[model samples]
Target: MKNMVKRYGFNVEASLPKVPNHPVESKEWLYGRTIINAVRVVMKAQDVQISIFGAENIPATGGALLAINHTGYYDFILGGIPAFVRGKRLVRFMAKKEIFDTPVVGSLMRAMKHVSVNRAAGASSMEDARKHIEAGELVGIFPEATVSRSFEIKELKTGAVRIAESANAPLIPLIIWGGQRIITKDIDRDLGRSHIPVFISVGEPVDTSGDPEVATQRLFEAMRTLLDETRHSYESQYGPFDGGEPWRPVSLGGGAPTLERAKLLEIAEKERRQAKRDAKKAAQAGGRRNPVTALIARLKKLIKK
Candidate 1:
C-alpha cells in the first residue's frame, strides 16, 4: 500500500479519494451520465427495476482491472451503481469509438476518458485499458467481446487478463444479469425503454500473487464464478439464462500466446504495407520518393491480387 502511494500518487496513508480529474466525471461526461440516470429514474417511475449486490468489495484506492460480462450497452447503467457506490466517483470505461463519436455523446465520452477501440485492428480494448491502469486509475472492461445474444453469457476475451497482467492492476470481475432489455438498435421500439429490472453483483478482487499467468487464470475463474452466481440468483426472478460456460481467458495479457501463423504473416504484411505507406507519405511530402523508399514499396506491395 505504501509503495502504491510513491509509485502511483495514491495516498495509502488514508482512504483513497475518488480520482479527481477522472475522465468519466469530466463536466461533459457527467452531464451525459446525469441524462442516463435521469432516463433511468423516469424508467423506474414506469417500473423499471435494478438490484445491485456486493457493493462493498470495490475499493476506493489503487488500480483495479474491472472485468465485466457484456450484455448490452445499457449494461453500463445496470452495473455502474456498484462502482459509483464504491468509487465515490465515476471510473473510465472503454467503449466503442463510434458511440462516443456521436455529436453529443461523443463529447461526453471524450470527457469521461472512455477508450475508443477500432476492432478491425484485431487488438482488444485492453491495450487502451492498460494505459489507464498504468496511471493508477480505475477502468471497467467487458470480458465478452460483444453483446450477449439472448442475455445468455458468452465466451470471455483475453483482453481483461491482458490489462491486469500488463499493467499489474488488481482485477475486479463484475456479474451482470437482466440488463439485456434496456435499449435497442431497432428504431420501431420506443426510445424510452423504462424500469427494466436488473440484478448486479460485484465479485471479489482477483488474487494476482505476483504471477501474471496465475493472476489472469484466477481472474478468468472469478468471472465465471460471478456469472454463475448471477444466473442462480436471478433465474427465479428473471428467468433462466440460456448461455453456456463462459469462454476461457485468452491470455494473461488477454490474447493467446500461440497466435496463428497466418495471423502473424498478416501482421508482417500489414507492417510492410504500413512501412510503404509511411515511406510514400514521406516521399510525397519530400517531393520525389527516395530510391530506398521506392524499392521498399515494390517489396511490400507484392501484387498477388
Candidate 2:
C-alpha cells in the first residue's frame, strides 16, 4: 500500500486509542467505520498523498462546528480526516437532501447519522445539526454550500455561524487543496492512480456568538486565509504554478474563471434548471388534460377488468 507512513505525510496509520466502555463507545458506528475503511482502501489504490496541518486545532472532545470551504466532491471526505486523526472523532456532515435520497448511499448516510438538508426547507436540517453539536458530537458544514468553479472560496451562508451560536459550539475553519484535481464540478473525472497530493489545513476556532453576518464574514476571511496559505504551500512543494492549471484559482494565474465570471455562470445554470423544471410540470399538466390520452387510459383499464 505504498507504505502508509512514507506515502502519507500524516500519521493516519497509528493505532487508535482505546475508548472506555460505555453505552456509546466513542459515538462511532460499525457501518461508518466500514465505509471509512473502504475509503482508505480506495485512497491507497489511488496513491493519494495526504498532508495535514494544524490537526490539533480540532477539539479532542465536545461539540464543535467545522466550517469548510467546498472546492470539490472529495472535500467532505478529506475534511474529516483531521478530526479522525486527532482522536478518531467522526463528523456528521450536513449534505444536500438529494444525496440522502439516493439508493444505497442514502441508507449509508442515515446509518452514519449525517444530516440531510433540503434547500427549500433548511430549518429542520439546521436544527438537526445544532442538536448533534449540542449533544457533544462534531458536525461539519460547507459554508460555501456548493463547489466553487473558480477554485476560490465563494460567498458563505450564515447558517454555520447561527448553528454554532445556537449550539454554543466551537466554530472551526478548514480548507482542502488539490482535491479538485481528483474530481470537481465541470471537470473531467480522474479516478485512476495519479498519486495526487491533497492538503488539509485546520484553523483555530472562530467566535460565532457575535452578529451572524459579521461572524460569517469573519469565518469567510479565516477560511480564505487558510486556503491561500495552503495553496502557496502546495505550489511550493509541487513546483511553481505555471499559469493555466485548471485546478488552480484565477487569482493564482490559473485557467479557472474569475470569481465574478463564476458567479455569472452559476446564475445561468440555476436559471436553466428552473426552466427545465417548469417545462416538466407544464408537460405533466398537459397530459392530464388531453382527452384522447385519457380515453386510451380508460379503455386500457376496462380491458384489464
Highest lDDT: which candidate? 2
TM-score of each prediction:
0.60, 0.88
The local lDDT score (0 to 100) that residue 85 gets in candidate 2 is 69
**What's model 1's lDDT at 229?**
73
User: What C-alpha lDDT does candidate 1 achieve relative to the native structure?
Assistant: 0.59
Candidate 2 colliding pairs:
none
Question: After best superposition, candidate 1 residue 186: deviation in angstroms?
Answer: 9.0
lDDT tens per residue, model 2, 93-192: 9999989999989998998889999999988999999999998888999998888999889999999999999998899998899999999988887889
Residue 6 accuracy (lDDT) in model 1: 16
* Candidate 1, 1-305: lDDT as tens digits: 11212102111222333343334443343533565467546645656555656655666656777778775566665555565545344557777766876998888677667777667753656677788778766788776666544343455665677677778777788887655555522112333545455667777877756555565667767877787676666556654444432211122111212234324544676699899999999888887777999888888888743
